[model samples]
Target: MKLPESQVAALNAASATDETPIDRLAEEAGLKPETATQAVFELRDEGLLEVTERESVEYELTDEGAEYVESGLPEVRLYRTAVEAGTDDAPAQMGRIIGASGLEGPEIDIALANFGRKGYGDIDSGELSADPDADADDDPEAAALAALAEGGAVDDVDADVLDQLVSRNLLDRHERVVRTITLTDAGVTALMEGIETAETVDRLTPEMLTSGEWQDVEFTEYNVEADAPEVRGGKTHVLRQTAERVKDVLVGMGFQEMEGPHADADFWINDCLFMPQDHPARTHWDRFALDVPPIEHLPEDLVDRVESAHREGVGEDGDGYHSPWSEDFARAVALRGHTTSLSMRYLSGTEVGELEPPQRYFSVEKVYRNDTLDATHLLEFFQIEGWVMAENLSVRDLMGTFVEFYEQFGITDIQFKPHYNPYTEPSFELFGKHPTTGELIEIGNSGMFRDEVLEPLGVEHDVMAWGLALERLAMLTTGAEDIRDLHGTLADLDFLRGAEVTY
Candidate 1:
């Protein structure tokens, strides 16, 4: 059978029974000296020939291989040389010969022996056979086909089987230089036509075209090219929509609307409402007090009652809880933290009369707080506040107002827990179902008009006041993931942008 080129060349390098240097042998054989010497050792071990250690090792094929070499036709080599010379059918022809099917183990073995004799498929160790344990059962031919698919025979081939295949005219055994991988003209055409293999080409057929399913789907071969439907238009933020809905409800309910300056002096905001000058809620952390101040002038008449209430409570012998009132504190400009400040302005001025003796009023305004912002806290937000006052209104009226307001928002799960605000006695805090977090969250705080503050304003009986935090309600309504979006900053106002106002 055909010997490895290195083995033949090494034998040629050794001359006349005298030692020829292994390095020189390697040079003649186009191999490293270590490779040449190792080939010599292999030939001797296979009983091809033996050379003394004192003399250099020489090599030759064994008797069986010699007999194979003489019998295999020279045309066998001529067929391979002619095929290799013709590039047109080389790859396909090579593929067929390499993956010869129906050759059982022993016949395939005989073919391998004949291949070596013909000098057609002789490759290096890293050329044909796959891993070390490759067997006929393992389908080395299929593995070689895969290797050719990726590129010329890969580095993962085994030396012995690769040499046999290359000798058999399957793989082109060009081992003098590194094999290169470049897309061939045929390969490029195949790729453009979306064909890689039988399986891939099978996917394109007249039956597939007849169904016209491709017409229903967008074909973005390179980039996403499906045109999206044109977005409609802009909208108000959900919180703003909520505030608007609250206002709509109040107005629809015949409650006259009222508003005051956003930067109202604390006097109009708090002192007018009989908040004791010493109340803890007035502290710095909870409230955003204006740094710049002359505490704007309190209403002359309201000031008299507010001041008197500070010294000796409101009416005769009331709670007797009075603290010195400060013109400075009352006039400091602040970010309004509660819509109730507008309510105070209503009670302290001509709006009080505009509301008949039995009157209702409401406001949906932004409020600011100074608390640490968290999942449920924001320095700025909205408040839905409302009140109805008449002779002898009771806690029942407060309940009615709360239920009505929440129902308007489609909120059914709400609990009015007993709470106390310094300005309201018998106060209750509103809590409602959180839409996403699924926890009960506080909405706002409200309570009846206390005798202490109302008497000073001159309405002595009970009046209902109720307020709910706007973000909590807005979150419930809009399924917002974060509270920051409520303040008009996180993203565009989706509420107004796409809202059909219900209230």
Candidate 2:
């Protein structure tokens, strides 16, 4: 049998009687660890070697531990300074010793507390004195940390000292799997039968392939199932992909896309949506207000109409807030909490042209909220906002639209709970059963726009609208347990790399 040079060398180095680590075999064979690992797996597949794996914890020094190794440990430095400045009978001021040790901030507290705990010194009445009997050189944690500063297995150090170093945040420990390679009975037979590892080619060159001498050359066997090196080509982000899919689905459903700024006036985000200026949602706790460049150039006529809606209500039976409503408050620039702002802009004929009956508009865009982050909530995320303007749109139309939209992504189980929104009358909160957990997850909110909201926008037709969390949909589609892992910094690269894109 013939093999690559790496595989041949690894097979020859394997122990027939006793187990040997792959690292040891690699070193003896003058091969790289990864190269040896590949060779070992290849040989194992061919019944020419046996491999075993065991997991162990390995420890390495942290940045602070490395710094202490160069200088001394914080307590060691404090002890040395105390010994130099004071005798056994006459202790130096604790503050003076700390300043002289060059430790600052939290390091000073660390130095003082650990110095006494290690029996290296004493602190009393603002005075510092060395133990006289305590030897800095005899410190086990410092010695262990110094040894590990260069890096080694955790088992190589004293457990007590390792614990102390870990507690001090001086070392990081993580589990590592060790592979041991050995010669099986079949391996010994293969060795005795004479194996060859020379002039094996992984790829065929044009010259070799064309030449008659190619007949004498050995071509490497291909394992099609073997993992290839990762080739990261340009691709849209996972969240962006979800957004695009949503756009395609909506466009397929005959909805025109809406576009607008991530930051907009509260007039459209709130006032036009019938959300009062003094509403708690407009406060700093729920909205991120911009400091520079207050929103201006709003259409004067539309401003008066919206202001009237806020101050006294709109049209017949429209009883406005009658509370203090300032145009300045409506013009305050802030990050949008939902893309419903885009829907409002569209419905009000502010972005595009005048709204016509039976027109459908949708936007999958980013929105910002002053929210506490967790497994399901993010401060910034994309919202799937869409609205349909038609004569007498009903709640069934709203629910049906949601079902059809989510159905495109294979989410079939949907339920709606009666909910409330200032702009949307008879609102409902959309829910979807989690694919994995089987729990009903709140997906979005939807309803028919109230007369108060539509009238100010000159939109007289009954309009159904929705604001769904794009991240939650992405989470449902990608089987992501934590919303952070769907698109944020904490996202799992492995999951993204292997995630199957379902239409």
Candidate 3:
């Protein structure tokens, strides 16, 4: 049988010894620990070696612990400095003692606190004196640090001093699994028969084949399950992929994409939607407003019509809000909280040419909200906004559109809850059952536009609109419990690496 050079070397070393730890064997053979581990496992898989593991503790020096190795322990430095300065007779000034010890900042504080607590020194009224009889050579912590400058097994060090050093953050404790490797009876027999150590080519070259020499050479056996090097290639982010899929789905259903600024005038976002200026949702705490570049170029005629709709309700028997209205507030710019602003702009023919009846528009874009981030919420996320401007549309049409849109993602289970929106009359919140949990989770908001909203947009036809959470849809489709796993800096890379892109 052919084996890797590392495995062949390790087996040879084990043939001479009864049993050896994998780490010690790696060191003696000049092989990397990880390489040794991989070879040992392969050998064990072939029944040529037997391995056993036991828990072992080890120590590594902390920043302060390493420093103490180069410059004695803090207490030892304090004691040495004070002794040289004549202690117990005339006390040295605290500053002078510290300066003479060559300690600074946190080190000065550490030395002073530890010196007095360890009975190595006495501090009185800013003057310091060392215990004249105390010896600096008996520092157990210093001795421990010196011995462990290079890490060692826990049992080999003083347990009391190790604990003290750990508590002081001078050393870090780690538990390790040490593997003991020994050759099996079969391994001995195989070595006795003959073990090949010379390098063997894994593949035959064209030159060797042409020379008719490949038949005389031995090629290494290939283990398909062996670990391979990682390769990373360029690809769109998972969230971006979801957004593109959304656009594709909408376009396939005869919807034109709407593109606009992330920072837009409130006129298109709320005023055109017939939301009153004094609405609680318009508060500064809820929306982020821009300071520079005030929005001053809104179409005057459309603004006037929207203002009238807000001041006095549209159509017969409709009463308008007698509350105050301001042109400046509507003209001010802010980060849009929803892509419904895009839908409003499109439905009103402000973004595109005058819209005829039987029109459909959609936008998959980012929106901002002043929100606290959690597992399900973020300060910013993509909104899948869509609108259908057709004659005599109803809540049923809205529900049907949602069902058809979600069905493309293999989501057949859907339920609607009666919901309220200022712009849409007879609103409903759409929900889908999670594939994993089977729990109904709200996914989007939809309703037919009210006359108060459509009249200001010059749209006499019924318009159905909905704003769905793109991240939530990604979570549902990807079987992700937390929205962060689908969208955020902390998104799980392993999940993304293995996640299958499905329609």
Candidate 4:
């Protein structure tokens, strides 16, 4: 009997009576697991061995779960604190109970959220009450975490409790296909007959070629049907690929790309957009402000015009907000919340000189915000900012532009709702039905630039502008249910690698 070196090694390691896992077989064979797997498949094809596959599940504690095991679960800590403060008899001030719990920041939220669900306590009207009968010592989730930390059998833990912990991100569950190999009757017979190793070269070597022995050497048979390890070579991320595609689409639509500072003065970000200086969106809570010196270089004439527009009015029928406006506030530096700042620069002749009518400009740029992370929202994301300057631009033109742009990405069922913006008149919030969830998700905001916004930049023509979420569009195109799945700490590598951005 004859076999390849790897196959002979694998066949010898495999047992006829006992099913051996591929890992142990590979170790005994002294071969790479992938190589062993290939050899096993080849042996199976020849009816010399049998292979079986089964799903194996594994659970690992997240960083948060480990922390809870060292300390205690947040809800457990809160309940114990409440009981210590005599809340088991009557409700106590929620703040006092939480303060004594020693839980701070996100931990406080975690405690309050789980405290009620776990039957640990009741919270109502800023008060907390611990259930005396509720046993924190027997908490299934906490017990599961402890059991996992101590390397206990997973079968001893409740499946439902494990699922709950996974939902809470305290545990990560992994599933894999584990293959087992066993020798067949033919394989036993071949071993009894004493199989000999065949000298098969996988690749021709320089020594063999120089010795003129390459022609006489036997080449290994190629098994195209064998399973190979996944090769994830370097490639552009789906998000980046979509962004570049967007750039190509915009450029094809006769729009020039715009570029500017990511960290810039509030003048172009909000002030020049006719946003009130005291508007809630300008506060530090909503924006990422820098602690550097105020921007020193600002167009003096453009600043005067914008200030006049804010203090007085744009035209005869225009009315400015009766809010106090300041140059110092406009000079304050912050990360641009939107790329409209670039539009302001171009419109004000501060970038690429003055522009004429019938001009289109666009930018695909990153913006910063103080937003809570969730399935749909991130702290930083790309914004598809664009505007068209032409004569007598109307709502119809704005709607038509969106229809044309979205059609490029195969999104035709766009919906628009009346919305309000500080800079655009007749503003609309654009939406598209999610491909996976069938929910209408907001994709962008658009409208004609108002007189108050345009007059400050000394623009006489009508301009339609928009600030669209690139991530949201990607979600629609890629059928991604969660924006986090597209890009973030929780991004799914498999989904990204397989997600196709169809034009």
Residue 78 Cα positional deviation in candidate 1, in Å, after optimal superposition = 83
Q: Give a tens-digit lDDT track for model 4, residues 432-466.
A: 99988899999999999988988778899999999
All models: lDDT? 0.57, 0.81, 0.80, 0.89
- How do the predictions measure up, each by TM-score? 0.52, 0.69, 0.68, 0.78
- How many clashing residue pairs, candidate 4? 0
Q: Which whole-number lDDT from 0 to 100 does residue 68 have in model 4?
A: 92
The TM-score that candidate 1 achieves is 0.52
Give the number of colliding residue pairs in candidate 1.
Answer: 20
CA lDDT for candidate 1? 0.57
Candidate number of the best lDDT: 4
Candidate 1: where are CA atoms >4 Å away? 1-232, 291-297, 352-354, 488-503
Ranking by lDDT: 4, 2, 3, 1
Q: What TM-score should be assigned to candidate 2?
A: 0.69
lDDT of 4: 0.89
Looking at model 2, the pairs that clash are 312-320, 313-320
* Residue 305 in model 1: lDDT: 75
